[model samples]
Target chain A: MAQIRLSSISKSIDGLHTLNNVTIEAAAGESVVILGPSGCGKSTLLNILAGLIPPDEGQVIIDGQDWTNRTGRVSYMQQKDLLLPSRTILDNVSIPLVLKGTNTKKSRTLAQQHMEEFGLLGFENYYPRQLSGGMKQRAALLRTYLFASDILLLDEPFASLDAITARKMQIWLKDFAHKHSCTIIFVTHDIEEALLLANRIYVLSARPARVLKEIALDDSANSTMVKEEILSILDSETGDTYN
Target chain B: MKKFINTAKKSSALFTLGLLLLLWEKGVSWYEIPAYILPAPTQILDGLLKHHQLLIYHTSTTLLEAVAGLSLAVILALIIGFLLHNLRVLYTAVYPLLVFSQTIPLIVLAVLLPLWFGWGVLPKIIIIVLVCFFPIVISFLNGLDLVDPDQINLFRSMGATKWATFKMVKLPTALPAFFSGLRISATYSIMAAVISEWVGAQRGLGYYMTLQQKSFAIDQVLGAVVVICVLSFIMVKIVDLLNFLLMPWNRNQLVR
Candidate 1:
């Protein structure tokens, strides 16, 4: 597992500053959550980390090496499951391996081995349309896992699900991350979700987003106190905009 | 309930056509209308059976031209549509010209094509290609452009190369729209072929119909119209079947 360090990342699109000197870090095997209001450039930060888009200024270091604007180093799961609707669940999960030049048969066999672990064992032959939302997200997660097991960047992966299903998936992911001992950087606007799943939470301001605060959690930490403090930080930032 | 409604809708269409045909047949006989103006259904049927061999020859000629032109158009549209999509500068330069090309009446081309290329199958085919290629290329380009942005980003984050992303995500995603265009183009293909034949051709349903018209054989002309309708219907059905085979995932939506 590789630790990730995103240092002073800044990005401007079409003269609109989206991110402002945003620095975030996660140790190996740690689960970090970036919590912010909607449209606060949280996804843009994740895109920078995933190397899908280059930040105007940043150094993305993983395992002590600079990986700036370099792709294929981290696995990314988008908000939508984005399973290829044309392929069966088995084939969808096997796509990353196939794209990496693994033979189709070999990739499918590898995917099948992990089906039971993802709670998608019986739905291998089912198309994406046949599966429920929760199952689709699970299959997507398995695909991300297959892409690279060391580091994961997830952008609101459970945001589209119903509340009950979303909680269930969060629980499943928390356990999965702990068991696998992989670095996970999750982005979401849901504060409760951030509190529930993250070992440490980074609260962000609104547009031209900057990290407002980083809260580390333990058994002794008061979640409500942490939540309230995060609220105030966000509230103060919101106040600054109006002023 | 939806399925029942769909079946009812289809049956209603059939019933309406049958009723109209029955009224036409009865009214022609009841009013003692001259066959030269409008032939009765039975008279048309009689003429179809009498000239079956001749009709078959002309039908085959039209069918061959339509199918050949359509196949050529499909191949060229896909190749050119893909090129335009991949190259932004080329698309910007050429796409407006494609739209501009559609404004010029194909009938004008039909007259001049034989003069330019000679009165052979080549001119008729060129007219069919001109008529059918635009819908396919434009629709396919729309599909390619409208692919989910997140899906492309997801593939990119997975280290998928441009070709890989195109094959796995873009191509399949664009198919339903492609088929929609193909269906439209398929319907037009036969009509275009026949029109070219009408302009000038030695053998085709269009030529046969013109011959019947000159001799005041309205029943035989009606027979050719029936063959044209049947052939056009068959072309659309073939496109539908291709869509079904190529896009199994879209089958459920098709049924709906």
Candidate 2:
């Protein structure tokens, strides 16, 4: 696990400021969630952290080293799962390993060892299109894990799955995070998911996103009051009660 | 049920072509139309059988020219298309010229080929490459351009090099489009060969047809035209088979 500190990441996309001096930190082995309204630049922030896009002004420090604008140092799981449709599940899961210069035979052997952990053991020979949505996301997560980075940035990874499956994945993810050393930065609009998975949660303001509130849920404080407080703050910001 | 319907559809197509041929034979005989104008189906068939050996030899020569030119065009298109795709500046500067080149008729290019290379296989091969490579280039470029942005992002995040990204992701995605280009270019390949052969080759369907026409052997001329049509159709079929083999995921879409 590595400590990640994002310093004053400001970004403008297509003439609109998306992240306004946004700063956050996740300690080693800690789970941090960026909870925001839809279209509030959560993905933009994750992209900056992933080094896919450099912020107009920012610094990202991972494991006490400045790693701005450098990629492949952190694993990234995008919202869509993004499994290569042409590749079999084993082949898809082996991509990060392959990218790291491992031979296909070795990579598939390594990927196959984790198929049961991913609950995708028998589906290894199937192409991505044959798998259910939940299976694809788990396979994608397995790939991200295999990327071997100490920090993982997940952008709404389970957002497309059905509610039940998403919740089940969250529980599985939390257990996995507890066992793994990587620091996970999860971005989600689901309040319940944030409450369940995060050690610390940052509620971001709509558009030109800045941190509105930071809630620490480290102590077994799964109270209804905390949910109401987060809800009220979000409801005031978006003028909607649904969040 | 699906298999039955497919078989029925194939049979109906054959039946329609057969009926049309029968009508042509009956009409020619009943109207007493001169053989010089449009030969009956039986006459064309007789002509084909009569010159089957000679026709096969010329057909083989023409086929060789088309296959050579088309294979060369594909190799060239792949190399140039990839270079242009990666070098956007070069693509921007040269893409219009490519379009402009397409407007120059194949017939004109065929004429110029003889002047440039003289009466040889080289001129015909060059002309075929020129005509067939356009669609190949365009389709390949389109496929390269259509590489998914998300796929690119994923590759970039993984710190994959540009070449690795192309080899692993872009190439697979571009295959269907490349095959599409191949299909269009396949049709052009044979036509270009025949047209080039028409200008000066000594042994091909084009040369055979010209010699027959000069002697008013309408049946033989029609027979050469039939061979050309069949050859082009076969090219299209071969491309389809290649497409099927190369892209297994796309097979589901071919069901309709």
* Each prediction's whole-model lDDT (CA): 0.91, 0.88
Superposing all C-alpha atoms, what RMSD in Å does each candidate have to the true structure?
2.2, 1.7
Let me know the DockQ for model 1: 0.80
What DockQ results for candidate 2? 0.74
Model 1 chain B: ten consecutive residues of lowest lDDT: B247-256
Model 1 collision count: 0
- Stretches of model 1 off by over 4 angstroms after superposition: A240-243, B1-9
Candidate 2, which CAPRI tier? medium
Backbone collisions counted per model: 0, 0
Model 1, span A121-222: residue lDDT tens:
999999999999999999999999999987888899998999999999999999999999988999999889999889999988888999889999887889
TM-score of each: 0.96, 0.96
Q: What is the interface RMSD of candidate 2, in Å?
A: 1.2
Tens-place lDDT digits, model 2, residues A1-243: 338999999999999999998989999889999999899999988878888888999898888888888888886887788888778899999999999999999999999999998899899888888889999999999998889646678889999999999999999999888887668999999888998989999999999999989999967686577789898898888797754
